[model samples]
Target: MKYVMVFFFLVLSILSCRKNKKDLINNKIIYNELIREAKQFYRLNDYSKAADKYEKAFKLIGGINNTKDGYNAARSFVLAGDNEKSFNCLFELTKSELNYDSYDYIISDTIFKPLHRSTLWNNLISKIKDNKEKNEKNYDKLLVALFDTIFNEDQKYRKSIDSIKNKFGMYSPQLKKHWETIHRRDSINWKKVKMILDEYGWLGKDKIGKQGNNTLFLVLQHADIDSQIKYLPMMKNAVRKGNAKPTHLALLEDRVSIKLKNKQIYGSQLMSKPDGSYYVLPIINPENVDRRRAEIGLNNMADYLSNWNMTWSVSQHLKMIDSIERKKNDIDFK
Candidate 1:
């Protein structure tokens, strides 16, 4: 009788644990769904609804885990004319580690321009600056600033290309000159990055600020394929040593694979159609792509693709690919 009672209790405990885990997953799904709706609202210019949805999702998650969503939430509230909520949201960010990591972006974002004149904004900036000063106390601040300068220059031309396109049009002489300028800068930046990597190795977020550390990847990403191939092994080792982010490594992997005309493992690469639609590039084992992405700390494919105004479903994608292949074969035969 005693043995049977112990066995029954153990079975119940195992079942209870399973139930709790399932419930946790379901809640996470719900939170992500809310965020998706919030982003959809923002895209549609319905700032009030976007703010409401973001607030709901944040409440469900207990607080902001990363600065991106919180920044979005604060911006939404500002656009919706809810100054109090916007202030509260930005205040919440100062309480997180993103305080130092996000200081530059938050300060520069034009969406927060309205809050700039207020006392609250001044206080927020003071707190964030303190966080940054504390974080950099033991590091070489000049080296950190140097990496930041490199990163800004690396991004300068790329960020301006869209505006230049609007002004001069694609394939125009002006655009050609712009590309030439960008390429020249890329060459200079690549040489600098190679020198740094050779001397100091991979400087991840811990050593440099987020943008500073990201300069390494950005420079190499803009370089020739040979440079990317050269650094792939080193980046892998950095990830193993906890000196780099696995998510960034996944993107570099996708870039190299796509350039080599091989299937990408994480489905991070996307190809655009002439009509302006986009589709994910070839992925290995489409059914398990999301599983692999999760292992590397990437979000769900559907959510990630939402940024590009694309919808994703592995089943739908596979079927579309099959249909296209069949049509191609029929035309070739004819």
Candidate 2:
């Protein structure tokens, strides 16, 4: 009777371990698959579906406290025009370890444009402010002022560019003059940014906070390719440490790569042909591009290309490039 009882207990323990291992594997698979699907939907601009999938991913991975998926779900909900769901996701985020710095993202991102006029938005901001310490609030105020200054300058630059485009048409001969003016203004802004970075050292998430970092990123996005390359390593490290979004870093990398005539790892930027057709800028490993993009939380290349009115097929693109290369060879041989 003693042996029988011991044997039964051993069997139960073995079965429990097996079950636990299986459950862990299943959970990991589901979490990864959900994130991939959500990114696909996001690339297709199906914000509602993206939000749903992200929420599911969050639940599977232990919710807002475990991952930043809830914040992404919130942004997607806003983009989908579901302010209520967006607010709910934000509320969930508030329960997590999110700090006053997250409030900066909530206020600065254009994704939350739909929620700006809502009472819920106001309440959330007020709640965040009230929860912060006095020193944090003062720092936040300073950050907000800097953000406002940069944002206003950006708005003016954009307005001027649009006015020029409207008056001269998109490809006008006189557009060069406007470009010169824009470049001059950009140079001045770049100088200001350099001074800030000299004092702040990249305006990292821990220093000036996320909003400040985002504002600096915006400035860098408009700067010359050399400037982007100089900061690329720091930005990459920040993304790896979860201090910055991978998508932003990917986009910047792609942009700089395109300018340098190098193959981009993430196909975030597109180029228009002379005939008005668009194609993704050169990609490094064209075959496994989507897989690489997925690893970094970006969407599938096909759907992302579709946004620029381009159809993506690896085989087809390869064939086209081959033909173009052959033609060039023929001309050179002659």
Candidate 3:
């Protein structure tokens, strides 16, 4: 009777642990879904809805301590013209445990432009500067300058493309002229980036901070394929050493591979057919692609592809690849 009781208690304990784990997973899924919806609203320029969703997500994830989420909520609120909510969120972020080193983003980010004229913004900036960690580096000013230059150029490029699209649709002959101008500007910027790389190798997080490193990654993404290939090893090493993110390396590697007509190891890049259907560019091992992606902190292929208005299924991808291979074999035999 004693043995049976002990066994029953142990079973109950195991079931309790499983239930807790399942609940945590479900919570994380819901949290991510909320974030995705917020981002979608932001992309659609529905700033008020985006701000509310972001704040709701932050609250759902134990509000006060989640500094990153709080900061995001604040930014979105500012964009939405909600000064009260924005100030509240920003204050919470400043008080949170996370050591946000850079105040430059608060000053320079366009979303915060509305807040700049307010006394609250000045006081908040003063408070953050006073409470900043003693050992924090001050490279953010330089980093912000670099980011501003890149951002302005990118905005111009995007606006030109959008104008052409809005006026004449996706495949207008007029797009050729706009693209040529964009490409020329991009090449000039790429030259500047190359000079920066020569002076400061790859700008890892240690040197310039995460935001700066992200800006560098954006520049690299816009660079010619050869430049991306040239820096692939350096970026990969940074990722391995935990100085950089795996996602950037994965994207660069996949892009370079696709350009070379070789199978990509991580399926980050996609191709669009003339019929508007999108497919994963040839990957080395489609069977375990999601596993590799998950290991690198990426979403599953299906969820990631959905951002581009594409649907993905592992089984369908496998079948498609198999059919392509069979067709190739038949042609070779003939």
The models' CA-based lDDT, in order, is 0.84, 0.72, 0.74
Tens-digit lDDT string for candidate 3 (1-334): 9999999999999999999999878877887778777777765678899887887777676774566667777777888889889998787767647655456556666667788788998888976765443323555557556755765664466555755765775666787778887787778777877787778777766666565677677777778988888877888877878767888878887888888878888888887676545688767778898899998888888768766656777778778778888998999999
Runs of candidate 2 exceeding 4 Å displacement = 1-83, 100-119, 130-189, 229-253, 272-278, 287-314, 327-334
Indicate which candidate wins on lDDT.
1
Per-residue CA lDDT of candidate 1, range 66-129, in tens? 7878888999999999988999888888885556445665676677889988889989898887
Against the true structure, what is every candidate's RMSD? 4.0, 6.2, 4.7
For every model shown, what is its TM-score relative to the native structure? 0.82, 0.61, 0.73
Which residue pairs show backbone clashes in model 1? none
1-334, model 2: which lDDT tens digit per residue? 9999999999999999999999989997788677667767876779889988887877886766432666777878888888898898777666536543345445666667778788888888876655443325445556556664665565455655545655776667666677776677677777787777666555555555555667677777888888888878877876777666878888888899889977788877776565546676657778998998998888788657654546788887677667767987999999
**Model 3 C-alpha lDDT versus the unseen true structure:** 0.74
Stretches of candidate 3 exceeding 4 Å from the true structure? 1-19, 44-49, 64-81, 99-117, 124-168, 172-182, 272-279, 319-334
Which model, 1 or 2, shows the larger TM-score?
Answer: 1
- Candidate order by TM-score, decreasing, is 1, 3, 2
